[model samples]
Target: MNVLVLYATVEGQTRKIAEHVAARIEGQGHMVVLGDVRDPGFAVPGTFEAIVLCAPIHMGRYPEAFVRFVTDWKTAIEAVPNALVSISLAIHSDNAEERAEAEAYPIHLQHKSGYHPASVHHAAGALKFLEYDFFKRFLMRRIAGKEGGPVDTSRDYEFTDWAALDQFIDAFAGQIAQP
Candidate 1:
């Protein structure tokens, strides 16, 4: 199948995840394209057999630019077999409250935008202090400290679960295979 995997990232974690997804799909003998939704000149082909849209949560919200892109291309995306995934720290949290908040975020976006995708995945994001400024590093470390993760600002951290993402993609592949 021809798949389009488009995403937007704040600190580059989501982009890496998206690339991983694309590589996996390609390895499965499918054609895939990866693009940033923020780039206004994104050349999405109309003949794509399936689509996967992804974005990372930042400050409790998705990037405004990505939201607009999805909203604007809702019909185009919906016409094909499509899925969405929201990456966030909440997905990594062991605390019930944090998980609930993270789960609610993508639902809220779906409700508000009225873009009901075939599948939705909430994957854990990362905290890369090595890529942040002083304040960002401190804030991320503080958040991580509360979540019982790494508090040191000298290194990076990732929480994405590849097995789960692969399963989700395989399911989509199956759906498109159905007659």
Candidate 2:
């Protein structure tokens, strides 16, 4: 299958995840086209047989541009096999409320945008202290402190589970390869 790995990112973590997904798909002997939805002249979602869309949540929601992209492309995307990778720091939180909030985000998105992907994976995002400006860094530190996450702003922290991601890709590939 020809799969499109489309993404929207803030601070670049989601882009990195998109590239990883594309690589996994290609490694499974399928064709892959990776693109940032913000880029000009990105291939239309309708052209791909399958798609894996990645976007990060910031301040409790996806970037407005990402919402717009989904609203515009959902019809085409829903016609084929598709998956969503919703990245958020909240996904890895010990707090049950925070985790539920993280999980509900994608459903709310689907409600608003009418894009019901066949599979949804909640991926934990990174805390990119090095990339943020002063206020963002300070706010993130407070958030991390409250949540028992890493508080050292001198370095960034990542919480993605690579083995689980690989397992998901392998399973997805298997599903696609079956007759």
Query: Candidate 1 — which residues are off by over 4 angstroms?
Result: 40-42
Error of 1 at 127 (Å): 0.6
Write one digit per residue (lDDT tens) for candidate 2, span 1-179.
88889899989999988889999889878998988888826566888788889999999998888888989999899888888999999999999999999999999898888888789888998999999999999999999999999999999999998778878877777777542
Best by TM-score: 2
Q: What's the C-alpha lDDT at position 166 in model 2? A: 78
Clashes per candidate (backbone, < 3 Å): 0, 0
| TM-scores vs. true structure, each candidate | 0.93, 0.96
Please provide, for model 1 over 68-174, each residue's C-alpha lDDT reduced to its tens digit, 9 standing for 90 to 100.
88777888889999988889998888899999999888777777677777788999988899999989988888888888988878778888998999998788777
What C-alpha root-mean-square deviation, in Å, does candidate 2 show against the real structure?
1.4
lDDT (0 to 1) per candidate: 0.84, 0.88
